[model samples]
Target: MIELGKVEYYLLAINVIGAVVYLINMFLYRHTSNGQINVIVTITFLLGGSAGMLLMMLFFDRKAVKENMMSRVFVICIFIIQIIILLIYKGHHAEHVTFAFWKFFADHRMLLIYFGIMNLVTFIVFAIDKVNARAHRSRIRIVTLLGLLFAGGSIGGLISMYLFRHKTQKDYFTVGMPLIIIMQIVVIFYVMNAGW
Candidate 1:
């Protein structure tokens, strides 16, 4: 019989609460706008952690999930972070989980740095493109934007799209970016699981 600790209990409680909130919002507030509902669901997933994210994904409001790229990206990111933390906990069995996280961070410092730089560059490019669009100047190409997204900048691209309201209405952007993110997540999980 494995005794659960405070962290385990807390994770379980949050997941249960998040699922309840999701179901309540889904059934009782069916008329709410996707944006509003997404806000609530995103908050729920953030609080609920990985299990909550999985539950929401499993029992998602399909229309909402389809329409809201930013929310989807945000939820995926939260899920990835929580999963990484859980993996670190399991790997090190450290008394302090933070130590485990720090160790992992140290081990993957270069990869993290690369992602940080790529995201920053992508964000700046998106901002520049938005400015260009506003000023009637030459703009970045769609191919370039998609390329950046493919190169570990999907998070930055999605965030910039939301913040700058650039290309938000375009089907390619609305659909493509999330798909890229999901692919990236899959590749990452595969690489990690493969011990590469």
Candidate 2:
């Protein structure tokens, strides 16, 4: 068995704390943007053992959703449909198809833990810039932030937006966020299987 040490013990405690905090924040997310993430989907994502999305919710100001009530309803409809499709896709190969994704993630828990840390560090840097970048504003510099925003840190970027009251705008999402989500998926998949 692996030996326990003070530093390792402390790190485990920190990770558990971080996971709980992120989970609490997730339920609070309902920004009037892309849509509220679906419950089944969010549960699957969480069970899939990835904490990145949960951490993302913690940083967004759900109240800033610009549209009115009807818009939210429309968004919700789309959101549910998208989630259903994602679930079917991820769980397609398993007997309990609805939960196939969860089993897969459990099998690759190491990669999920790795992904969680990657998101946390990137978000901290983004959060720092969210506080410091306003005065030095230039389109080019802003572009770079947007580019980084598209680099597997959508959750962090979203979190930074609300926590700093920064980058919560629509376009930052229309382009940057989706790209980052795609990139994150690709990276996670690579990391999950690259060495095996």
Question: Considering every candidate listed, which one attains the maximal lDDT?
Answer: 1
Best by TM-score: 1
Measured against the true structure, the TM-scores of the candidates, in listed sequence, are 0.48, 0.37
Q: List the residue pairs that clash in candidate 2.
A: 32-65, 59-159
Global lDDT scores for all candidate models: 0.70, 0.48
Q: Please, what's the RMSD in Å of model 1?
A: 8.6
Model 1 residue 132 lDDT? 99
Off by over 4 Å in 2: 1-100, 135-151, 178-196
Clashing pairs in 1: none
Residue by residue across 1-196, what tens digits does model 2's lDDT show?
A: 9997774565455445545544444443433444444554435443332333333333442332333222222233333334444444444333421324456579878756765665676577666666566766432344445545544456766676667766556554444455456555544443343333
Compose the digit string of candidate 1's lDDT tens values, residues 149-196. Answer: 978998998999999999999765787788778767655643444343
